[model samples]
Target: MTMTDNPPAVADGFVVRRSIDIAAGIDRVWAAVTQPDLIAQWFGDRCRLDSLEVGAGGAFGWDDAGDFPFRIEEFDPPRAIAYRWSNAVAGALDPLQVVDAHSTLFRFTLEERPGGTRLTVVETGFESHERPDAVVEDHRQGWTSELDELVALVEGAA
Candidate 1:
């Protein structure tokens, strides 16, 4: 995976934004972002999408990071998907619980370019969490690596 020069930026205080261009169509990119099997290949060790609808919820588990509860807030196929997820904590939580101030919003947007797709990811609401700086920094590194992996997977397939 070739990492792009696009650096993560702090937006609206604690929000982090990262973007990359992938050599694939919007449908392919969307699947890589929304499908659990495809997401696990890059985003985490394992992922289980309980639901893919706008009001659905899911869980992602990592060997080292434990589990994260996520709820889908928006689902626009081949374009955008927005969800709120809990920060990495020690214990497991209820995926159906309401998103509190501590949770963060992750939004993935795809735009069709001339030859491929431009993917942008924005994660916000870190200021409401404890150790906002550390969380932002951790996710900054994580998104960079994960997005690079996504690019590698999708582009390789192309």
Candidate 2:
């Protein structure tokens, strides 16, 4: 995975292109990504997953925030998982007004590299956001920290 010294470029109100290398096997990385319990340790404050099967749906959010509804639009075990992220109502929270106009896609690609696994996350379809730059930066930091946590968790460094 290429570690960019700069954040990815924001194109059409959407930022794309960032990858991370984890010192773990694809299976380990896949588990950390697809499993609800482990995902929260790395990605979110809390994760509520119904299934990892293709076209399945789930909700994941910070413990302090409401659950964000999501649907598994595409899934390929141990290789890729693409999902639709929404700020819609999950538990008493109204639909996210800021995210209502934009439909974002999160794609996770995993590959077995020579030393470990290379994980790439690409999010697109953000040209509709009023503040796309801010959103991009938010995700940039979020993914970076999450990937770091994932590496630590899978490598027993945490």
Which 10 consecutive positions of candidate 1 have the poorest summed lDDT? Answer: 1-10
Model 2 Cα lDDT, one tens digit per residue, 1-158: 43323233233346665687777789988888889899888777877777778767776778766677677777898999987776433454434322434457888999999867888888876666567677677776677677777777877731
Highest TM-score among the candidates is held by which one?
1
Tens digit of lDDT per residue, candidate 1, span 91-116? 74554463566588899999999878
Question: Global CA lDDT of candidate 2, please?
Answer: 0.71
Candidate 1 lDDT: 0.81
Could you tell me which residue pairs clash in candidate 1? none
Top-lDDT candidate index: 1
Candidate 1 lDDT score at position 80: 91
